[model samples]
Target: MDKAKHFERSQDTAHDQACDPGRRALLTRAAAMSAASAMLGAGGWTALPAWAADTAKPAAAGEAAVRQGVWRDQKRLRDVPWRLRLPAGEKPVALVVFSHGLGGSLDGGTEWAQAWADAGIATLHLQHAGSDRAIWSGGLAAVKAAASAEQLIDRGHDVQFAVEQLLQLQKSGDAAWARVRPDALGMSGHSFGAQTTLAVAGRDFQMRSAPDLSESRFKAFAAFSPSAGHFPGGIKGITRPMLCLTGSLDGNPLGQERDGRYRRAVYDTLPAGAKALLWLEGADHMTFGGGGERGAGFGQRLLGRERDGAPEKLAAHHAAVIKTITTDWWRWRLLEDEGAIARLKAPKGLNADDEWLQG
Candidate 1:
């Protein structure tokens, strides 16, 4: 599918009138990103403040839930094409911004974004120009040239730019972007996108020439199939709530961990407690992208093949796993739903093949 057009169609859909100023203010304050000092507390359930603990509470059994809506527009963010998925009602909710992996389009993590939107959270899909699927424009040659210290920094700023743009919309009271709950924002990425997530979540690099990419706006992070950068400096323990998703076999031949421990490596560096890790059994690089022939052969050739014996058959089940984990997790972080945090602590609802481990 023409990735650019895919984003265009996303904005073409009908949008429901969103939250009023009063409701938007309430949701934003309730979900605002916590201070770094607050995050430093022991990194476990016990560290959560009374209000944070209160946010973790679940809804009554018989209560009706909110539905979600989607809006797409290629020009919404200028050069950065995007798709916004929001909750259906006029009440405000949490919002998450997702970055696509290398050689991936905005829809790469569609299933997860859909899951968030379905549960009354908003999701903004970001398509970074330099490192996105467009890198494969001329096949392998372009693909080989895709990764660099430069583009990675650009990817990180793209997210900041998106957030800044929304802040502007909030000021203008624009019908679409303005409705986002001001303080209830989270960030996530897949593969190369995971590297971007690391950059935004306070991970600095060796190059001084690059822009200061650590963004305070994104209060939490979720990285899928994250890769190590070539430059020198690295990540220390991140303080915010984080969920690292990786598979036993999810390694890139071009990455530092040839044995597929890259995901765990990133997970290891995050502060514990508000942090969790999901290591799906038999998952691979392509599984997170919904499984199929991907890349322009550059990725396939350089990395050979990063897949299991029955990757196609396992794709659907893995999709469900991502959906369940992300939906419940955002509920914990954004809504302050105590029950969602409990669900994440145990994660018994996922497939038996999955392992839910925490810091």
Candidate 2:
């Protein structure tokens, strides 16, 4: 079958599942059973396995439950929502905080967070006030009001605030976060959010310091389709490992410089050993979730249509490769999962033909 036909079939299947109550219930029950089995298998319901567990369990509690919560960063005051997903237990695992690109929200990073969460890692997805994609669709006035340079600065501060808030939550007896070790933190962002992560890591990009770094914390960083225009200066000071993921055709006139040159400049300048860059061929800025035909603007605009290749299929392939590689990178760097690094640095041919590691 043609790629379009396959996509349509997948969408139809998903729609049917959503509309069919019986299937939904059955799926939910199956998921619950799987979770229970994983917990109880051989180990007798021990709170996660030792490799995955963060802290020692108390006899009274039996095993700690992975906790999920949502809270606002008062320091941001932009009313953006941030969601936290932590493993169920008292053992604090390394934390991975995600920021969204321009016009993206907490929901934008939710799938990525969920992917990591399912892998036994914790994630925090932050929704930037005024700067998410909603502003773009809301009209030019809204976009101008939210996507300003000042707003970007505020957004960067929001990232710092999120880190501080997570640390505070850990200290304040938040059951869902009791096992979170604030010291073991990694930051990631997509597009402008990727720039924000750089700013929080003290990379000398276009962003200004919030003077709250003493309280804010992170150990490593990853960025996807980072906006080069906001390249904060002084990135050389960042000693932590960094990863940059971009597509050959990601340049969008609106935010990221249309020419891949800017991203190339930034990625090339970063110090070598601790940094890696992945380039996906035939992918544009919108390749992640929203650009495909099945996305919000399917009929209105050809978000993922490519002349040389099947855009939708290529985009899906890129997103999957990114999710897999990134999760492995985080596992290796943050959780000290030695086995994950090899998988991350493995040749792209193993997953997708279009994937390439660039210098």
* Best TM-score among the predictions, by candidate number: 1
Candidate 2 lDDT, tens digit per residue, 1-359? 43222211211110011111223333453455456556546432122111111233232333223333344432222354666666545566887887776556656565566567657678777777666655666654454344333444556666665665666657777566667877778888766666666667665422122222221467678877654343223555555788877676666424324434556445766766687777777666556432311211221133343333444567667767777877787888887887886676565543454545533
Cα lDDT of model 1 by residue, 1-359, tens digit: 33222212211100101112222332332233233225544341221111111111122443223222222212222266666666656567788888887677766677677677678888877787767777666665555455544455457656776776666656676455566887778888877677777778876443233346677877678877764432213555467777888887776634344334645666676656677888887777766653322441237555465444755677777788788888888887877889887887787656677788877
Lowest lDDT sum, 10 consecutive residues, model 2, at 10-19
**TM-score between model 2 and native:** 0.68
**In model 2, which regions exceed 4 Å deviation?**
1-78, 87-91, 205-216, 230-233, 253-261, 289-309, 348-359
**TM-score between model 1 and native:** 0.72
Question: What lDDT does each candidate get?
Answer: 0.60, 0.55
Please state the error at residue 91 of candidate 2 in Å. Answer: 4.8
After superposition, the stretches of candidate 1 with alpha carbons farther than 4 Å from their true spots are 1-78, 206-208, 229-233, 253-259, 290-298, 301-306, 351-353
